[model samples]
Target: MDSRGLIIGMIILLQTTVGILGNFFLLSHYLILYYHECSLKTTDLILKHLTMANTLIILSKGVSHIMTAFGLKEFISEIGCRFSLYVQRVGRSMSIGSTCILSVFQAITISPRSSDWKGLKTKAPKYIGLFLSLCWILYLIVNIIFPIYLLNKKVKSQNMTKAKSFEYCSPGDRDGIMDSLYMALFVFPEVLFSVLILWSNGFMVVILYRHKKQVQHIHSTNVSFRASPESRASCTILILVSFFLTFYTLSSILNACIAFLNSPSWWLVNINNIISMCFPSFGTLVLMNNAPTFSRFCFIWIRNKKSPNFKVAM
Candidate 1:
């Protein structure tokens, strides 16, 4: 491989590795908490779903980008291409939707007792499963149409008159109607989810500011700055939303131009995938910083590692 290819491949490999491992650890933490700890909290359940989706994104997008980066052409068959893109799109959408739900739910959780939306605090947890189910169903159904129109790079026409190409896959057919449907099915939900994420984050920020002021007012000189679990979770949502929106917006813009670019550069395609996966890669570590259970789990793990079980030499 050339220098550029080598560098791109290495970067993708690192991202994929970190994203997969981090997400798996987070997912396991939540699962253990759910089964061993009696029951999972509502927010933890949402995070479990988010972590699962991030892992899916890593598997779908990371593999394709790595193969493309190192010039592994046509290694994937048509069915593989279809499945990859379908999984990629669905995972990306689900990740965004979960983040949106998380931010909104946290906002509701932290709202003042007198707030009009306070009742949701009691009722929202009941519907989380339904919300997640709908999210999966919506994205899966919408992206299901792409398989028939996708081709492995090997079989894709050099000049299908008009085509949208990815590094390892291409649209076998396209018309105005299909294009409209693509925007409707894929882009619209992404846009909606992003907006919701922003709105919820904003709400949480406002709530936090007001709460801080109230705390300060009551305690003139000796107020505790230590944040509560709700505050920390709100901050996590804010960071996650900020990180997610920045990359999500850039990826969307690049995706819009992919169909128009006569031949997109190597850097262009891989960079788009990189941006799409960036939040998933780093977001887990961000959550880890805030997750007390994860910290405790790590602490126990390291202590155990430092003092391994062994028979002393007599």
Candidate 2:
């Protein structure tokens, strides 16, 4: 109820609102396309998964933060804490994994015909469903550790040296074996996917550069050095991956600091939560802007509404 708390609540409220609207719009747009077209492109499928994951993440974290900010943490029972944390972790992992897959898929799709990865371009679309299923299973197994140690306990007036799973939950039990297992299962996959995203991004950049050189040499006048659709898609994926990495890294570092501090600031914890929520919140808008079809529709809709006499050219 203090000024700082109010400010944080307002910020989270804004993020939650924007995130819900953007993600809902993106998801609904794709659903309409899939329903009418009777099938989805590979990228569209991946995007649908990403939007679902992002929406869950926003709801889980955003609502929890708002409740805490408003001094209504009691509503989150022990079961609620366990379920919300588990869902949040799963959603976070899915966001990372799906984005990584999307990047790699684009890399393969845009690979040179002579490249080894070129063969996957035709077969990748067939396996997207399987890949997404596996991702959910993997993350679910990893986060099953949540409810084991998460307890709904009141926050006592005591200095803490580490972070708890939730504001209303007790500090996580100190089991070295469980801690190591969690790291291996949770952290390992995140690091692996992040590395894959970076590698795929680099490969796509190199391929695009070489292709541009070839196109220029073949016809300096006939071909303009404009970004191809593949290049634009790759760039958008790269931006998304970069943003996720930045936000995740910052939140991780802050969490680490909080773990070591003898007296962790509550505001710092709120800030970390806010940072964790940023990727899902703003990343949807990035996807909307980068999507040509959606962007065109939005442009035409807005322009026509604003100027009744104006017409958009196809």
TM-scores of the models, in the given order? 0.88, 0.86
Model 2, residue 250: displacement in angstroms? 1.5
Once fitted onto the true fold, the runs of candidate 2 whose alpha carbons sit more than 4 angstroms away are 149-171, 217-225, 297-314
Off by over 4 Å in 1: 149-156, 160-166, 218-224, 297-314
Task: Put down candidate 2 lDDT per residue, 218-281, tens digits, no spaces.
Answer: 5667665677787788788778778878898898898777666656678778888789889999
Candidate 1 CA-lDDT value: 0.79
RMSD of each candidate relative to the true structure: 4.8, 4.3
- Highest TM-score model number: 1
Q: Where is the poorest 10-residue window by lDDT in model 2?
A: 152-161
